[model samples]
Target: MTLRLAGGIDVGSCTTKSVIVDDGGNILGSHVLYSGTDFEGASDIAWRETLSLAGVSSTDSICVFSTGYGRNSVSFATNSLTEISCHARGCLHYFSGPMTIVDIGGQDNKIIKLDQKGLRVSFKMNRKCAAGTGAFLEEMALRLRLPLEKLNDLAKQADGEVTLGSYCTVFSGTEVLEKIKSGAALDHIVRGLFHSVVKRILEMDTFTDTVVMTGGVIEHNPFLIDLLKTHIQNDIVTPPHPQIMGALGAALYALQEAPHNMD
Candidate 1:
């Protein structure tokens, strides 16, 4: 029997994601893995797991597309697309109308503005600092001796307002410890961390209205949606699985490539 299957693999700084879809644009399987050493090897591991989850074999698959930071290194992909283009296509697949995409991954964050048809109009990225990225949060979590999820949950419980004073992780970590030494409430410090991340994103402050958030951080901290909502001045939207949006977008692009196959 022949199977018309298309796959997409996303290799990010912290994690790898793969998505497989049938001709009808239905997800057959998906997997997430860590990116270590060469991305080519990592993509293979991620794709193998995804195939296992879908209960399929290499012989049953068709074209594969790759996206994300390491797309160029995916030897098996028929083609590669930039993460920004893939993300726009993916978000447009899930929702329509004016959209602004905010993706906070392990090493960086991006603000992408899309038009009504899901076309990217403009975008800004922050790769220079860790303050707005997951790396920053992970370091802060280590300092606080709290699981990252617990940090966000703790932030949700804050009774008093607090602000983190530094954009640099080292300075912020020092200040955070000082606060703890002074008997400051744990929730206050947690809230301050979330606030600092939001503040850093606001520094880009380029897009407006219909903000849609996607990334692993949101997966761990759903309360970030509310915290972000408080800071933004426009409508907000998020998909059911924002963390997988990049991979999903890549799959969506595969579908678009063969519309006749997409039922």
Candidate 2:
């Protein structure tokens, strides 16, 4: 019997992710790339790379779904979904039972509450400011004159004693500079920044016992997970590919919808 494949593309504000899966819900291939200024171009590249890794061609009969900020830009999508729904479904793919999802993305952050049956109970999002998003971290890294990739390691080396008083990104940047001028330890400052991120998420909403985090920020700086765990004092988890959970969820949706499309 021939195998059926399904594809999902998530065009986020800062990154685009693509995933291909088999009928049995197993991932075959996935790819991630910067979204840049062209959402369509990024989606095409991500989709092509994912297909190549899956050893499939563009002509294959795969159901395609898209989600995220640029979901509407995916001209090839069979359908598009809201990022909230996709994130909830994607996180639930790995973890069962009622849970909370914290997705920290480039431009914004989301907190989704799910009931025992996997239905969305409610959600909160922060889009008015960059305080708790990846953009905030990048700006902080720029102010610190450190590479963005070094944040995780530097944070891990800290004593975790430092705490930033400001939650606004601009104010936090000024605060970081003040700490530098005061001869504060660099590692401590980094950890403090991570602390701010966790604090921001905590203020977003109350979480359930099981909290699953997903998105590019978590994928890169996993130490934030440890920080969050300490604060929430609850079970926390992340999927295998945190950055691609939206795309993976989209693919899972495709798998379910594919049968209806059969000739």
Candidate 3:
């Protein structure tokens, strides 16, 4: 029997991810890497790693789709789709319902509305600043001398309340330091930071009963779930592997492109 393969690559500000899938929509292999040096090089690395994981080579795959900020720079891609479309398609494939997708990436945050069929109907994205993204949290972590994974749990333990000012990450860091100097409790300050970022996301004006949040930050940030519920008055859903949604979405697209009988 001949093997059929298709692939998708997503290059974001801080990471590169790719997926390889068979004609049947089964994920044959996937990989993630840091986007170092430049997006083009990082994308190439992720594509190669993804193919290797699937025990296939780029020459063996018939179709390649590139998404994310660096999609246009991946010359090997047969077609380029915006991450918005690919993410929506990907999320719908897994959840299979009418829902809103909240994707918080390393550098940006987006809200996508999907119909009952899992098709994207509308979307809003905040990319001009790093206020509500993983990068913002990383910066705060560095300044607070706290591990990223511990932030959510620590925030949940706050004994008092504090309000963080500024949406720009750098300014927020400065504000956080000032609060620290003023004798603010660490947990309260941390929870305030969560509120600050969540507020920026709320400004997007997108609300839905069923919402799914994905990305690296959400993977370890339990505080965000409470923050989201408070702002949207809705529960937030997260997949077991929230960080891989983009890559999975890309693979779904590849499956739709490859024509063959795998079942």
The candidate scoring highest on TM-score is: 2
Rank by TM-score, highest first. Answer: 2, 1, 3
TM-score of each: 0.92, 0.96, 0.88
Give one clash count per candidate, in the order shown: 0, 0, 1
- The TM-score obtained by model 2 is 0.96
Model 3 agreement with the true structure over 208-256: per-residue lDDT tens digits: 7588888767767857878878767666788766776777777677667
Each prediction's whole-model lDDT (CA): 0.81, 0.90, 0.79
| Root-mean-square deviation (CA) per prediction | 2.3, 1.5, 2.5
- Stretches of candidate 2 off by over 4 Å are 260-263
Specify the poorest-scoring 10-residue window by lDDT in model 3: 55-64
Order the candidates by lDDT, highest first.
Answer: 2, 1, 3
lDDT string, candidate 2, 102-203, tens digits: 999999899999999999999989958879899999999999899999999999988754779887999999898888999999999999999999899989
CA error at residue 121 for candidate 2, angstroms: 0.6
Query: Considering every candidate listed, which one attains the maximal lDDT?
Result: 2
Candidate with better TM-score, 1 vs 2: 2
Error of 3 at 69 (Å): 0.8
Give stretches of model 3 more than 4 Å off.
57-59, 157-161, 259-263
